[model samples]
Target: MDLNKKIRVFVVDDSMVFRNFLIKSIGQSPRFEVIGHAINAFDAERQIPQLKPDVVTLDIEMPGMTGPDFLRKFLPKYPVPVILVSSLNLRVFDALEVGAVDFVRKPDVKDEITSKQFVSTLLPKLLIASNSRVRMPRGTVSSAPATTMEARQLQTPTPRTMEHFAGENKIVAIGASTGGTEAILDVVRNFPANMPGVVITQHMPAGFTAMYAERLNKILKMEVREAKNGDKVRQGLMLIAPGGYQMRLVKRGTEYFVSCTIEEKVNGHAPSVDVLFNSVAQNARDQAIGVILTGMGSDGAAGLLRMRKNGAFTIGQDKETCVVYGMPMEAYKIGAVCQQAPLLTIPSIIYRQLGLLTK
Candidate 1:
């Protein structure tokens, strides 16, 4: 936490070559100090308590005790922030749900270009993870994770009525970055299948959003899919902005649709929350609800403010529940949030906004 002290890092991977490469590259950074390296979970478990690194880089696939399993076992004891270094593996999301803070996709092969790309992704992720708080590895306190139906029952009123919501053509715009994956799930899982259209922009890469959308569709009651060039924003459907593309809301008559474009990164992310929020501000005005969840940077602050100024209902995740508390904090500071609540409470707040639920 001291500004003068470099962030301590521990590297864990089964490949000796990859481990050394990480050490050599990460050691060169002025902001980081590679305190230790481990070739497997057992090695990491032995050294991590003694080293107490600010952040740990772990590979998801190893000889034994995979990264998620390691996190499942070790995080309850040590509680150090962890970042997963992986390829196109969905198990990284599993680790994140347990305790891992973030991840960087490994390049296909080790080369100069891939190395540079990996470092570019890893550094900021590490910075965020080093500062992130681990709260009992996320799912431990709950006997089992809440299903979408359970969350819906808890957060909304009975009978699952959409009479008001569908007629009004309301849209919900959500944005988050670092700790967004699970945070978004926590919030949206609470919504009933008949709720108004919802659009999300979580700062993920191109390949991952598709997988994320697929996972969400399977678990959630409503239809959830990655946004395309001209996807309608309608009731009982959630559209996630494609990674590496900027998404904007456009109104056609009384209905709303999304425009996904492969544009330059805004605020350091391609599917920038600002881009989506700003568009929602313009198109939906008072008909929309904007929610900003936990994230690492100030991406959605200005846009949320614009939404509030245009009479949109804006909610922010309170600091106590946030993993990083950066994006929502910025939005709150700028008078953007009409109500600040915990992650699980946001969907009910949305229902209240639409008069769907009294509480």
Candidate 2:
């Protein structure tokens, strides 16, 4: 591979060893190039403006100014994709909430496996972020408003066939890529404990989804956990597809559950949102609701459309609320989405449609 289209990366960490490790790893791959390295956020602040790298790998803990504080000051000014390299701590969540694109666990000095894993995990996100728009200032997240006619024009009748899916054993399936964890958590947290089963594919690496599930379970009214092979899709439970495996629906008679197994990537993702959504569309069809959330690619669009064709109700998170707006936008373009709602409203809309809640 000539690897000519290199993604320019800026490395920031207080540790020289880690910085050099990252530089070497990135250099070994022709797809990425290290443009600059900084020991702390102040140095980063000065150098970033000069380098203007396409992506930045930032350390959560630094001597003078922390990553989040740096982000508080720098993000508003330079809103590009930022991936946090951090230890397992509360700060990771804070970094996530602050709009860090992705995260990787820091590796020790002598651990080649861990270092390789971090490099592999980061490559995909960096590739995806390369095509993304520049970050806007914090608190200015909203985009231009839509015209009344444009809003009205976009609204379509919720398909009547979707009503039949409201019966027992119903499960809602969602899939997304870059910028999806927060999006999924925001939607899932709003559901009451007694809501139907939910399964999600968020394009995360091994070991991350379990932690994400644990985090969501703490805040959500319903149960949230990473899916293991043979896990039952029970009511009030949200199962996230574990990283490094494909999750599909296994139905025997009326009972259905998630089946986790290693499989090739579909649409550039293993355990793809489409794989799960399509399985539900095939097995649960009239008893499933498929949602396509914010992401950088068309991974879930075709599958959500398949769900619609199979008589499942379908929803797409609208553009203004999405971090990337690529996945939902594609689904909407194909007429796959029956209901398009902002992230905040999606939960209520789903609950209302399922008769789980009254308007």
Candidate with top TM-score is 1
Local distance difference test scores for all models: 0.88, 0.80
Worst 10 residues of 1 by lDDT: 158-167
Candidate 1, residue 7: Cα displacement in angstroms equals 1.0
Task: Show where candidate 2 strays beyond 4 Å.
Answer: 1-8, 24-33, 86-90, 105-121, 133-168
Which tens-of-lDDT digit does each residue in 172-270 have in candidate 2? 898887778777876776676766788999987777778888899899878999999999997778999998899998898778888999989888788
Candidate 2 local lDDT, residue 148: 72
Provide C-alpha RMSD values for all models, in order.
Answer: 3.6, 4.9
Candidate 1: segments with Cα more than 4 A from true spot: 141-159, 163-168
TM-score of each prediction? 0.93, 0.81
| Residue-level error in angstroms, candidate 1, position 134 | 1.4
Q: Residue 32 CA error for candidate 2 (Å)?
A: 5.3
- Backbone clashes in candidate 2 total 1
Which candidate number has the best lDDT?
Answer: 1
Question: In order, how many clashes per candidate?
Answer: 0, 1
